[model samples]
Target: MSTATATPEGALPHRDLSHTPWRVLVLGATSGIAEATARIWAREGANIFLVARNADRINAVAADLRVRGAAYVETAVADLDDIDGHTALLGRAITALGGLDVAYLAVGILGEQPRAEQDTTHALHILHTNLTAPVSLLTWLSNYCVNQGFGTLAVLSSVAGERGRKSNYVYGASKAGLTAFLGGLRNRVDREGVHVLTIKPGPVRTSMTTGMKGSEKFADPDKVAREIARAIDKKQDVLYTPFQWRPIMAVIRAIPERIFKKLNL
Candidate 1:
């Protein structure tokens, strides 16, 4: 039987896949959250399509998943900043998996605010990587999944998107655009048997925040992965990774703009 035709035991929402294996395509496979999520899904018996820019890192992650009992694992290298490559990358991932059941767009960059302020190029790069690329990829994936008549498109947004703050407004703005985009995508695909989940994580301890100082209420990558898996299984529309961020962001959103501007968050 073809690799895609071989069904992995214990795949979620179990279905007869005589032509394809139950597969997940993770865009930022080397990222902490994506890596954690990949491990969790591997444990659950799902084939993984690990996509990242770094070949070595992606291969290492794929190997790690194999060691962790992943039924099947594949890696693809693509720089998300290459706008022309988005659709092709998604298509390649789908083909690699023989099909796709879940597509996680977890690729993002958290650039330094001070650097962004000084360099327009850097700012635009961050915006494109964080917002534009995901939007374009999801648009393609959404149409593809809808045409296939099933699948889930999961996006990792941020609590920072809830409201713009002085510290990371550019980053937050990009996430804000993503959050809004996913909201519309969710509404559009709900009746089509396609699931769209927008994950808003307040603070996560990942390489993205490496060297950042001080203790804060941060969610571990593993914890965030667990929440993501649960949200996918439950077909949840929106999720706050740690759950507490929902109320916290609500309050942050409610803060008077004048007052909010006065104090650094």
Candidate 2:
């Protein structure tokens, strides 16, 4: 058990468990980035609550974490798109863990841009999954952490959100909304002693982008995970996972709309 402190939200008091080990809840536990992060945190002796919709994959990952020296490993199943399921899933994980010290919101879908534009259903699903779901989950989680008085909430935004490109603007748009939401969320919670880290990763070679080409600049999931862990320790406000992407995206974001539209990015 850790020492508890009162927070502004008055939900659940937080504790300084840093001297002990950490307990982390990872949404999208099956994601390459999330899985890698879990491994890194577990290696440092954190208890892990891995949440994902796939039971087989989650269990396998949990087992791996235990073998790798995690203090404890637990699993929860939920599809991010299912509102009720996501709520129940998170509630159960938090209860099982006793408390949450860190949360990584790492679920997203990258639908085909053309398909999303052509189909309302596709666009809606993408928007809901990427933007709305995360916003809702973070709102709940942040409140919980704020009341607890100390915790870090890391949200995975993207460079695409900085400026939409013709190549994948629909997906980019969804991320854009998420980025904005997280910005406001950070502002609202920081005063309460809760840290929010907005991570904008440019490219990653994950199963999600398996067929994508020209990804030489992509960061590895393991590297990204390590960076995230370091950022959390430092209480960073926002981070470009690779560090290099900050300036790269800055230039991209500064491009004039007319000229940017003419160029094939």
Each candidate: what lDDT?
0.83, 0.83
Clash tally, candidates in order: 0, 3
Which window of ten consecutive residues has the lowest lDDT sum in model 1? Answer: 1-10
Best by TM-score, which number? 2
What are the per-residue Cα lDDT tens digits for candidate 2 across 13-89?
A: 55575455787999999998899888988888888998888999999999999999999898877777776555566
For candidate 1, lDDT tens digit of each residue in 95-150? 77777788998999999888998999988988999998887788888877776667
lDDT of 2 at 60: 94
Candidate 1 clashing pairs?
none
Q: Pick out the ten consecutive residues of candidate 2 with the lowest summed lDDT.
A: 1-10
Give candidate 1 regions above 4 Å deviation. 1-21, 215-217
